[model samples]
Target: MSKDYRSFFGLSGPAFNKQIPAEAIYRYPHLEELHYYLAAAVADGAVAVVTGPVGAGKSTALRAFLTNLDPLRYVVIYVGYTSSDRALFREVAHGLGLSPSYLKGDLLNQLHGAIEHAWLGKQRSTLLVVDDAHLLADSLLTELRQMLNFQMDSATPLGLLLVGQPTLAARLKESQHEALSQRTLIRYTLAGLSRSETSEYGRAHMLAVDGDPDVFTAEAVDLAFQQAKGIPREIGNLCVYALIRAAWQEVRSVDRKVMGEVIQAQKGP
Candidate 1:
């Protein structure tokens, strides 16, 4: 009978679970810089956009930033995959604990009042973060620009954060979004980890779960890194399956041969 992987590896817990706490997420140079820029933008109530390919840690970075925000002083509204103009406004209103309106103009007015109440009245700041903004239509992007124009654009009471893939940046550059483009205070693009960083990433997760650092051999680690192409999600998935393979064989460590088998299985015929 095959032993359980965690028991076989002497691990205290699962090393490569899908969910990693925001604070515990691995941060490289680019993510560190993104955090700094996001902090500054939040303080200024400015607009910031973060773009990257899938599994590049864009959402992870944003989660880390939001986790660090002081709940007493800042109100964070997070909307994912904004499909329509009304959906966007509806999300904002719902996030603020207010009734949502189907009318765009009414929604805007309601959002403005919510921001004003949160900021000027309560001395708190509001941050609205929209993920998968690339899916939003150009008209919806224009609506974002109009939201920033509240209070005559004299003072920024609402902080806007847009997160999406590389295509989002391309969309923003188009002439239709020119005004919104100009309003963007900070722009950042996240990249995947390098080979060395990928190895470190594996070790970090192992340690986080109280597993042995040398659970994966050097050759196995290299294979995982290469196959994952430095994407953290891919790395985690590869490593987890490699561990399972080792455990099934009643082995203590995953080596190159086991990694090769896992990779082959992943790329089925």
Candidate 2:
């Protein structure tokens, strides 16, 4: 049995719950709209820019979205990290299962071939998802501008996505990267959860854990959500702490008082 809420849930805080945690997960209130927009962006052969605060679920949204698409229907490449062209090349190559030795000469040709092979063989759409795009170095950012030149002569354009924190938007707005910025055909900044979403969010995780949704009282959820400030990570942390507190008290459910005590304990010097 899992020792605590951290073990019960995933350690990174609220990435997902135990059940269907690895599946294509969706959340309430505008999630469908966001889904629609991302799908449309990729279909339109345009790069989508997703930005959000620290705990805003940018990574989660992209991962969930990628899982929703059929692998045969969409060859997706997930790259998380820096702003280096060489690094980008390595990541793209790694995703494509290309050998690193191919970079000796005409490496771009190899990658273009890889892209073509991935696209034509399966007859599926090819998507490149780049996470933490704000850290992209200026050189690599420019490389994207150049890499856009790599589409097959066919009408279908390659799909590229940049997911990162809100600062990514500001970074794109910088004057130097204007050329690269202009290519971002779509942009979405995930908003934090609302009060209703917060309660549902808590209940959803509890349900995912196969625990009673009523394990957390409405007042308890409200206080936890307030302390969480609607951030998914924060909500998960507060809920876990509340659960530990309730556990110590031999209570199956958490009340506002128990939740408050946990919060206070966390903030105590």
Candidate 3:
């Protein structure tokens, strides 16, 4: 069995897990504002694009938004990763509770029909979230553009959200993708956490697992933020390492010296 860090630290459970509850995830004010924009985009049946560097909490924000949605009024489909157009359509079909076809065109028709029925016949909203969209081929991007062409007007029956790394925006700006880019309703780029946000984030996770908020000294946290560059994933890694290092040394609290040792250990042999 894997080592139980929580028990070792006299805590209730794993604190730094990626799959923590949405409510438990620290909601910096900026992230909450971004979530508001995304929620509005979903309600208006718009194609929204969210770009950010890896480990910037884009997926976490998406999960929080979906969790708060009204299930009776909206159908949410999340495809975390898709490499090809056929796979994308198949995922959508599966999300809609339909068996997908081998043919790409047939799959497209089936997905569109299901989306229309959900929006019109059932009076429900359809939200399709495609994560790691940056990896999709150009041809697939064209197909996605066509799917959103519900009517002559800009209004679409389905709300689409494309989430990926920062390079996704540049890909959309290519000449061949102008048509799709023009149809984007809103674009938001997620940035790393600010210093204050990082500090609060650290305390939040530690406290969530029943660890003392002051387990890490202020100077130690400052070093962590400097080393992690305010990225949540990196911060989590540094914190976990510090915890284990402190336990090994029989230290009650992590200080700058402990963090420095952790950083050096992470550097190399």
Residue range 171-223, candidate 2, lDDT tens digits: 88899879878888888888888888888777777666556667788999899
Global lDDT of model 3: 0.85
User: Candidate 1: where are CA atoms >4 Å away?
Assistant: 152-154
Candidate 3 residues 10-117, lDDT tens each?
877766777877888899986898898998898898889999898888888888889999988899999877677787888889999999988888888888888888
Root-mean-square deviation (CA) per prediction? 1.7, 3.5, 2.2
Error of 1 at 203 (Å): 1.5
lDDT of 3 at 238: 94
lDDT of 1: 0.86
Q: Candidate 2 — which pairs collide?
A: 83-136, 83-137
After the best TM-score superposition of candidate 1, give how far the Cα of residue 76 lies from its true spot, in angstroms: 0.5
Model 3 pairs in collision: none
Per-residue C-alpha lDDT of model 1 across residues 126-206, encoded as one tens digit per residue: 899999998988888888888887663465678899999899999999998999899899999888888878877888788
The stretch of ten residues in a row with the least summed lDDT in candidate 2 is 9-18
Query: Which 10 successive residues of model 3 have the least lDDT summed?
Result: 1-10
C-alpha root-mean-square deviation, candidate 3: 2.2
TM-score of each: 0.94, 0.88, 0.94
